[model samples]
Target: MCGIVGAIANRDVVPLLIEGLKRLEYRGYDSAGIAVIDGRDVRRVRRTGRVAEMEAAAQSEAFSAQVGVGHTRWATHGGVTEANAHPHISQGVALVHNGIIENHDEQRERLRALGYQFESQTDTEVIAHLIHHHLTQGADLLAALQRTVKELTGAYALAVVSRAEPQRMVVARMGCPLLIGIGEGENFVASDVSAILQATRQVMFLEEGDTAELSRDGVRIFDGNDEPVERELHQSDVSLASLELGPYRHFMQKEIHEQPRALGDTIEAAMDVGFDAALFGDNAGEILKGISGVQILACGTSYYAGMTARYWIEAIAGLPCSVEIASEYRYRAAYANPDHLVVTLSQSGETLDTMEALKYAKSLGHRHTLSICNVPESAIPRASELVCYTRAGAEIGVASTKAFTTQLAVLFQLSVVLAKLHGKLDEAEEAGYLEELRYLPGSVQHALNLEPQIALWAERFAPKSDALFLGRGLHYPIALEGALKLKEISYIHAEAYPAGELKHGPLALVDANMPVVVIAPNDRLLEKVKSNMQEVRARGGELFVFTDQDSNFSESEGVHVIRTPRHAGALSPIIHTIPVQLLAYHTALARGTDVDKPRNLAKSVTVE
Candidate 1:
């Protein structure tokens, strides 16, 4: 993932552009750059490191202007060098882009035939040249942008500033996310609201194939066909304090501790009333009642959230459920039932693969669609027929902590609602579940209280080369998530398998050098899980377990145990996730790795 920030105001915007890029550092980028329309010329500065380097480089230059664009580039088409940095200039036009261009090679050849020269080996440079080519043929900036986008393929969120139109900046989006921030005598544009939240909370999310023209006076929007369009400007509810790293060492650590609050906010509305179908949308109750089954689509951590939901839906609602990786689902000829509810889960809601899978499913006559997402303005929510907004706020860390747990909370709520709708839960049963739901935040806090003990375990794991995580029944997905967290932040080779599946294959990888993490919740499968632990111990594998307080598990030579407060009846998965997150956080701390922004990973996967 890359980031783009643009501004048009009455004052010097170089500082604003730089600060905005700093806010987007969580999105993960290698090189950073900025371009400003300084008087009659488009002045540019580029750096091959963090945004701080770019900011320092810009401080030395006299590139002061009222309009500018900034970019944080994650290498996709070329090497991570200063030359490949964005604000790729051609003729009088300078632009920064966020997504891939599929037709860049052909366009480059055509532009070369027309005597256009290239500087960087980037598909983004082609856009600059294409726009310049159009401007040379007597088209204005907006017209040139519309015409250039018409000839390009694939996803992109572009912000361009031109010397020909020094008073304004033009931005366009096709597949990737883009939004405009409103202010007095100024306007801002960025890939996410966090980038511009400091400037203005009032923002308008751009729809697919929409374009916008920003100026010091105001902002204007247009569709792909050059027709003027109107979009609602909504005020964002994200507090700037939520984005800060208060006393914690990193955002991941802060987010791990913030789980109690995040889960509370996510499940507050559904805790007392079970779940109101009307919270989704109009006719949502009818849609939920009519669905024969569920088909869930997601990627990465969100996919694991769906996998956990599959267990809850089938067991509680008594309906079959299937979970698919969105990327694989779109490429194959998968069977779709019109009566099956299609559910999509994502944090940013701009996940390209998941969005495409939803579209693919809809094209096959899967009429019922629901999106459980954190961002309300994102494309997935707009494309969905019903939406369950996860109040997780803005998750800044590349390794998701609060977002994943909050999503699990939402998914559990959906499961309870479905079970009640299907007549599986009577009044007493529903009240019991509601009481359990109300206590989930406290359960999460209880798990967090074990962090001091978990940190000691992390010290043992930090020096290890590999890890294996095991869980039984509904906790299996929790095991998978635990392994993913370890591999993502600590740079260890980690794998997860069902407790029963250890004998099948993964047991061979277990030894003293490998740490095996087991999630034991004292459910019906506790006895079976205990047997699985014996197999690990017999193989001389180091075992670290997170279980309920009432469990018989205790510390031994190779066995380490951290007990939670109590067993949450149906919401155990949500509580079980906190210790695993803290384990990864403390382990990464012990290894001195970048716990928040892991290498080769971004907070949001906007590109395929």
Candidate 2:
């Protein structure tokens, strides 16, 4: 729930660190700070607001240092204040962290007993004092970090520095993301790729329990056993052009407009050449072969993604799939069998609830776990046997546009592969599915071109304070996601219910002021969804329906129907999701909130 950036250069590193923080603003923006080394002393600058505020503060005369580490924070453990902002410092150790310290109380108590004083209200400040404590005990920076981290509990991705040792930086990761970018006489580290993409594309990914000691010249890796380990350095291959807005007003708007290319990238990269039965490879499909059912665990947008996947699994793969929010999955014991596959979906793949739930599933002997994620090398992927990664690249906006669609695509593709492998789908049916998959890229582009229709709809209804989203079966989760998006950024009161659930309590909330968004996509559930639309109209609700022109939904009463391509219901989850994304993007812009970085929300959920 925070963004961290660090760098050391033969030249001054403050400017590079500032640029990296600007890139990371999408991750978090509530408070910002940077601590830099000035001739073996640390000078700290911090602000209690956006990155621009901190940049303004840093440019003042008093704050200047050579080598630095910075952070933009989303408050998790403490109130938002300038002192609570990251790059928390002690006498010499200045630290930037991205995850929560679950046992910070113990660490704090121990540090206090050792006569160390804390200066801020954050779990991260304990790390500063702990590192300082170890260094005071005559330990070197790397050894002090190693020994200090051993006493800590819970997930973390920490980048620590010591003015006592000015030439190098030490980093360690447990369940959070940390990457090192190689540069010419300068090196960089960040919680995500977006921060360091401008400096270097070549990076060394830090695995769990691995520590990296970085210097002006190079980086060295060591394992938990204190043995030197050789690491493979991969050149990050993402195109920088995808990160640009290309004249769009906001990143949310640019991302909504980029859905066509994003979907195209996912589908094109997913096509397998042969009838090979190994799409869910690396012993992941063995869960299906070994299990009789599936339990899916996820949270928020990914939870909706899981709900959509449940429909495909039941309809296409002929498997029973249980979809549950991960925060609730552990509290209740479900009736399970050994043959149950636990699947999880996450855009960042580091969501705390989902990660903990997956571990609980494994401990319960649910051996088969599959993860669908957009980011490569995310924490959840490391725990799963089979992982289908969405190559949608870096999604910066807090309200996900591409990652949600790509998760469904990957899940759908996985279901198809499983159906073929398990003999649930024959060769002819498989070929038909593949043919539909081929048209996806064009269909997504077509839907994107209809943004004018969505903008017009927004103009018609942006003044309303509340809305109702209705769908059925696979479209049910799409409506839920649509409502979540509107509520998340626009601060609008939005509720989604299964189209059939209108009379079951949701109808009581429908009125003249309520604008209803009915997803009338052509599917087996079309008639039920149409009847639901009429039910809403009977209650004096204005209808804005998205449907296929080829479908009979156009003739439905009391609804303004906007027609899109008539794709299969399985494909409609990705195609029909476009207009709702547009509506939220426009509505947030109308409400005058930060569309790209919504308040109290971060792009990546790094901490629990």
Candidate 3:
């Protein structure tokens, strides 16, 4: 995921574009560049590494322009160098693009035959030249953009500014997020809402194949045929201060607490159960029932959701399910059947690994394809039979908190839906499941209230260099995620093991010096988890249990217990994840680490 911003200023806009890019650098920061259209011509600057570093390099120049576009790159088709940075300029037309132009190789050959010279090894550079080529042939900017898009394949969100037409910025999207912000006397364009939060709250989300021509006065959108289209602008409630890392010390922790609302919004993305069948409409249940099996591809937290879904889908829907990491899914020798369904999940929907995996799976001719995504109009969504979008709005934290929980919620709901379709679960059982699913928002909200207690709990263990995480079944993955989060920000050496794995080998590491964080949520594994805790205690390991208050094994001899209100199935992880998030937050704070922007990690892994 790359972050792109373009502005037609009623106010001085350089500072606004730069500051916005700073907040969004978590998306991608391999290199950064900006191109401003001065009255005379377009002035451009480019540099490699973090945006702060690039800004340092650009401090010597004075760039004054009312219209401009900026991009922070996560290199995909080219090496991370200044030459490959975005805002690629050709004949005074600067282009900053996100997503891949899949036909770049063939298109590059044709352009070379036409005597076009390229300076960088990026698919984006091809766009700058392609647009310039059309303009030189006497096509207007909008006409050139439209004609050039006809030959292009795959996903792209492009912002083009031309020196010849100094007042306007041309933008188009096929499979990514693109927004136009309406301000007092100007307008703004960005890949996400956070980048333009300070400029204007009113935004129009560009639909696929819709081209936008933006100027200081207004924005005009057109359909693929160059026909004018009506625009719908929604006022964003996100404040500038929300983008800031406030008193809690980290955006990750703040985002974890936002799950209650994020989940609510995700469910609201499609509320009609009785009418207008979601994603899969009137014949959804029938088609799903006929499908033989499922193949799922995702990465990071989204992949964890897939792992959890396999359990639920198999048990509840009686479907054979296979989950693979997006990065590896394509390279392996996969077994594909025409009756098999392919499912892809991503929060940004522009993730490079997942996108590639999705295209490859589609090429195999699956029975059906579905995308569970947060962004409604993205590449994967466009290439699917159905799309179940998670409306977890604008997760700002580099580490995905709300996104992971909401993805799990969607998968959980889908499992119940499939069960109802297959006649696997009875009405009483199905109602019970849905009823518990509905309570998740309230449960997660209550868990967020335990943040202060979690902060206190973090105090005693921050100095420790190593921690152990234990759980069983689904909580096993939650333990892995907890350990991963702790290590991700706190830089602690943490390992997760199924509680039963203690006697197998992990118990060897337990001693008085070891501090273990046990993810003992109330489940079928609680008794076994208690036994694992006792073994750790006998060996003098400091134990911490995140369990329900009602469990009979309330207190270990020398261990600390962080009790939950009650133990509920499927919803426990949603609640239990909060305390782990808080613990990671406070631990990082105590250790004086950058909790919001962790070292050596970007928010979106757009590059493979």
Candidate 4:
């Protein structure tokens, strides 16, 4: 994922770096660029596609500068062209990157053996020719970006701009996400806070090996022994008018109607401070009473919200959970149970494989991490020791609805505070599961009032191409997050089994033009998900269900039911994920696609 923005200003910082690259264009829109400096030289503008075509090619040049840097790119080592865009300039420095400089081919062969002539197969133009080869040997610009980030390794979040330091803007981060943004005379830097949350909600958030410079009067930070630190700004309740789309057509239907106010502000701060396994660390109730097992990691819809919290932490935190998939748990080498309580999940806790799988489970000695994120200052909650944020604000839809129902309402309030700290629920069954999480935002507003009956089954699934979803015990990760929100915004070709694995082979790809979609939640797996929806209506599959009106499944002909007004026992996967996120936002608004930037997908993966 890419998207960066920087500014140092008293004025024309190229329209605040093109409105913070159009609010971090959902973290990467193929290509876009900007550089600025100007007086002493840098001034650039590249483009390949969106950021409104690089803001109409920076209004055909003469990009007035007050110091800048910007980018939008999502290309990794190189391809979406305008010569692999980004600010990536060289001699006069100018940069802009988001992760993956993985030893940029041995530092681009030691800056091409010191003659440095590369153009654009970018590892971000080899960090602008190794910061113009350490500012042409006499190191300056923050010691040539701290000696070209100590000769680079992996994951970055750079932002640079020099032209002999025309006012300033230098940034860095090791894993990914960067921040800053306190303004007035002007200072920013991004990678997201919804691109400086419309210029300043007083940020900071740059931790893992931080570095900063930004100046038109503030931000200094540096550490990783470059010393001078101090970072804690924080005033961001991110509201660019709740990221607008006011009457909603898409920010995925204004985050599927802001999932009942983002699951009532993520379980209303654990129902106002009661559910506590020490609210996740004051030694989290002595690590939830020495939690024996439970891994999680995540990716994609937070790995189906850690497979629906491994069925609520093994059915109400009796423990023994598992989940993985943080980019295959950081290249597969297992058995790291130093009292395994490692958890992760990331709405944009800069997920570079869930922050390298929580630094490979803290290098195999796990020591109880936790992150259930929504950016309490990213990098997996600053490399997790404990966190739970998921306020689920600012999702900016790259296919995630209210951050997967506020990370399943913070993994069902960390499985009811680890099932009441492992006695497996006491105190009136944890006050009846905190009064069913304070009545789960009215059962997710009765599943967003079944979005006009799932938009009348998304107008019969917007001319279906293929679909299947189904469910069973624990609604099979809510039918694999409703076939990954209908193949992430209706590219269709969906699938999801576990309705007793549908004849162990996906019922040979169900017929009558697919469309099975069950998740019939009434509980005890509703007659084995109604005999797997009668084996997808005895083969002419075309059922749809999403049940709950006491699930005696109805709608006669080929079966279609919509239900979901009540029965959310054990909080039915956050109320059946709001009618599977309004049937993938009304089937990607009936196939017009781009349901909030869904082509190649990039809300935040922060590069592999």
Candidate 5:
């Protein structure tokens, strides 16, 4: 993922651009740069490290301008270097881009044939050159961008500023996200609203294939058909305070502790209104009636959430359910049934693979689409027929904590609603589930209270180079997530498997040096999970187990036990997630790794 910020205002915008990039730091970046139309020249400063380096350079160089664009680049097409950083300039036309250009090689060749030179090995530079070519042919900046986008293919959110047009900026969105921020006598453009939260909360989220021109006076938007269109200007609800690291040392730590509130907020509306088809969307009830099965499309953590939901859907709702990795789903030949509901899950809602997979599923004649996402204005929700928003509220850490748990909360609610629709649960059973749902926030808090103990276990885990996480039944996904958290932040090599699969292959990798982590709730599978623990113990593999408080398990040699709060039955996975998150956070602290912004990873995967 990359971030873009642009501004056209009466005052110098270099500071604004730099500050915006700082805000977008959570998106993950190896380089940062800013280009400004300073009088008659396009001046730029780029650094191959943190935004602070670039900011210092801009300050030392006295960079200032009324029109500018900034970028935090997460390398895709090239290695991380100053030359590969964005705001790439071609003959005074500077541009910063977010997504990938699928046909960049062909376009590069075409531009080369036309005598346009390249300075960087980036798909973005081609766009700048292409636009410059149009400008040389007597097109204005807006017209040049419009013409250039038409000839290009693939996902991109681009912002262009030219020396010839110092008072203006042109921004476009195709597959990646882009938005325009409104301010008095100033207008800003960014890939995410949080980038401009300090400047303005009034923003307009551009639809796919929409382009806009920003000036100090006003903003004009054009649709895919090149016709002028009016997009609803929204008041962004993201609070600047939420983006801050307060008492917590890292955003990840703060987010892990915020799960109780996040879970409560996500389920608040459903609890108040009572679960119904209408909770998802106006027509979700009708869509639910027609569907006989569920097909989930997601990536990374969201995919794990989907995997957990598959068990819930089949066992609780009695429906055939399948989960697919969004990136792989599109390339495979598969049957798309009209009777199956296509459900997409994402935290930011701008996940490129999942978005494209939704389109692919629709092209294959899937009749229904539902998006369970955190951002309401994001493309996935706008494109979906039904939407259920998770109130995680701007997860800033590159590694997700509250977002994943809140997604599980929403998916569980979805499961209950579906079960009720199919008559799988009567009133009393439904009421019992609802009561558990209401008490989940408290259950999650109890798990959070175990953090001090989890942190101690983390001290034992930090020196380990590798980890294996195990679970049984419904918590298998939780095991995978636990492994992911450890590897993601702590930089430890980790893997996960169902406890039953220990002898299948994973057990061979276990030994005295190996650290084995297990999620053993007091569910029906606890005894089976305990038996698997014996196999690990027999091999002398050290075990770190997060179990329910009422469980009979106790500490012994080569075994570490951190008892989580009482399991909430079906919602136990959500409860068990808290301690693992704590373990990862504290372990990363012990290892002195960046717990919030993990190396070589971005919060939002906007590119395939």
Candidate 6:
């Protein structure tokens, strides 16, 4: 996923565009560039590195413009070079894009036959040339973009400008995220609202196959059918300060520390008004009564959250549950029943794989579709029949921190809600569960307090080339998440296995050189986990145990124990998640790696 920002205003927009790109730096990018109309021609500055370098170049060259479009690109079809950077220009038409163009090679061949020259190895350059071709054939900027997009196939969010139309810009969204920001005497476009939040709080999230023309006058939108349409304008409450790294060294660290507040806010609606099936939608109660099972589709960390939910649903609600990775699920032949509810989880609801999996389930006659997402306006929530919003706020870090914990909090609530509806939980029992949810934020804060000790443990883990994570029962998914966090940020090789499976094959690789991390929360499976810990110990594997306060684990010989607050039943996974996050954050710090924007990883996976 890349970042796109555009503005049409009376004043110079170079500063605005640069600041927007900086705000979007957390999305992960290899190069940054901007294309602006200077008087009668387009002036461009491209860099092969960070946005700061490009900004410095723009300043040294005295580049200024009243209308412009900027981009931060994560390499997809091209190498990390300035020649392949965004703001790709062709015949005086310049554009920046996010998402893949599936038919790029075909289009490149067709354009080449038509005497159009290509400069870069990017799918985006084809878009610039195609639009310019249409403009040459007597089409306006909006009409040309409309004509150009019709020939392209695949996901893309495009922002284009032309030298002939200095005050005009056009933006389009096919299957990727693009939005228009409303400002006084000025309008903006960006892949994420956070990029334009400094200039405008009012935004309109464009739906599939929507294009809009932007100018100092106003914004005009047209639907897929080429007819004028109106989309709702939402007032974003994200503050400028929330996007900043206040007091923390990195956004990942700040987000890790914000887990308590994030969890509290995510479950606030359930806590305040009590859990009604209507909290999900108007007909969720009826839908819940008719469902015999749940089929969850998700990707990455959200998939792990779904894996954890599988344990909760089957045990608490007595419902059959299956968790499938969305990317793989879409390619396989799977059974989808109308009586089973299809649930999709994504932090940025625009995750293409999960969205496609939801469509595939729908195509197979599944009717009850629900989505758990953080961005309320994102595509998945809007596409699903029912929705649950996780209010984790803006998760800037490429490696998720707050978003993962908040997803677990929401999934836990869903489990309890299903139990109550199925007569598995009575009034008193439901109240007890609610009480546990009430104290969750404080429990998370207690876990946050373990940061000091975990940071010390991280120093010991920093030099290790590989690590093993082990857990049992409901905590096994927590182990998987821990290993993911470590590998994502620290670049260390890490793997997780159910504790019982450790003896089967993974034991052969255990030795003093390998560090073993175990999740031991004093549940019924505590003894089983302790047995696995011994298996690692016998092999002389250095052990790091994150246990509960009363678990009575001691630091002796090769064993190191970091205790969290006493386990909260059913919600222990969310609590155990805290220490592992801090461990990864601090480990990345000690290894001198990029924690916020991890290499080769984008915050949002907009393309499949």
Of candidates 3 and 2, the better by lDDT: 2
Judged by whole-model lDDT over C-alpha atoms, candidate 6 comes out at: 0.93
lDDT of 2 at 499: 90
4 versus 5: better lDDT goes to = 5
What is the C-alpha lDDT profile of model 3 across 1-608, one tens digit per residue? 58889998766677777877886876746788888887878888888877887676656787767888999887788888889998899888898998889999998998899998889999988888899999999998888898888778977889999988877889998766688899988999998888988778898888778898998898999987778998777878666766775775456776787788888876653444511235454556666777877888998878877888888889878888899998998887676787877889998877768878988887776768888987655557767787787867667776778888888888877777777766787878866776776677888887788877888878876888889998887787788788888888889888989899999999999987778888887678788888888899889999888888667655646788887668878667767877787788888888888776676666766555
- lDDT-best of 2 and 5: 5
Pairs of colliding residues, candidate 1: none
Better of 3 and 6 by lDDT: 6
TM-score of each: 0.99, 0.95, 0.81, 0.37, 0.99, 0.99
lDDT of 4: 0.80
- The candidate, 2 or 3, that scores higher on TM-score is 2
- Candidate 5 structure quality by residue, lDDT tens digits, 270-386: 888777888898888878867899999999999999999999999999999999999999889979998999999999999999999999999999989999999978999999999
lDDT of 1 by residue, 193-300 (tens): 888887899999998899889988988899988899999989999889988899989999888888889889888877645567765677889899899999999999
Better of 2 and 6 by TM-score: 6
Residue 544 alpha-carbon offset, candidate 1, angstroms: 0.7
Mark the regions of model 5 whose C-alpha exceeds 4 Å error after superposition: none
Give the per-residue lDDT digits (tens) of candidate 2, residues 73-160. 8888879888788889888789998888899999899999999887788999999898888888899999999998898898888898
Best by lDDT: 6
lDDT of 6 by residue, 258-343 (tens): 88899999999998777678778888999887888999999999999999999999998889999999999999999978999999
Candidate 2, which segments miss by more than 4 Å at Cα?
62-66, 269-276, 282-291, 334-336, 553-558
| Candidate 4 TM-score over all chains jointly | 0.37
- Model 4: per-residue Cα lDDT over 1-608, one tens digit each: 67888888888878888887887776547888888877887778787878877787678775787888888888767688898888878878878888787778988887788888887898888888888777788987887887788878887889887778787778888877788888898888887877767767888888877787878988789897799989888898888987667887667787777777877877776788878876666777887678788899888778887887888878887888889788887898888879878888888777788788788888888888888877676667766788878777877878887888778877888887887777888788788888888888877887787688788789888898888887777778777887888887778888787888799898998889888888777777688778778877898887878778776766888987888866867878778878887887788788888777877778888777
lDDT of each: 0.91, 0.82, 0.80, 0.80, 0.92, 0.93
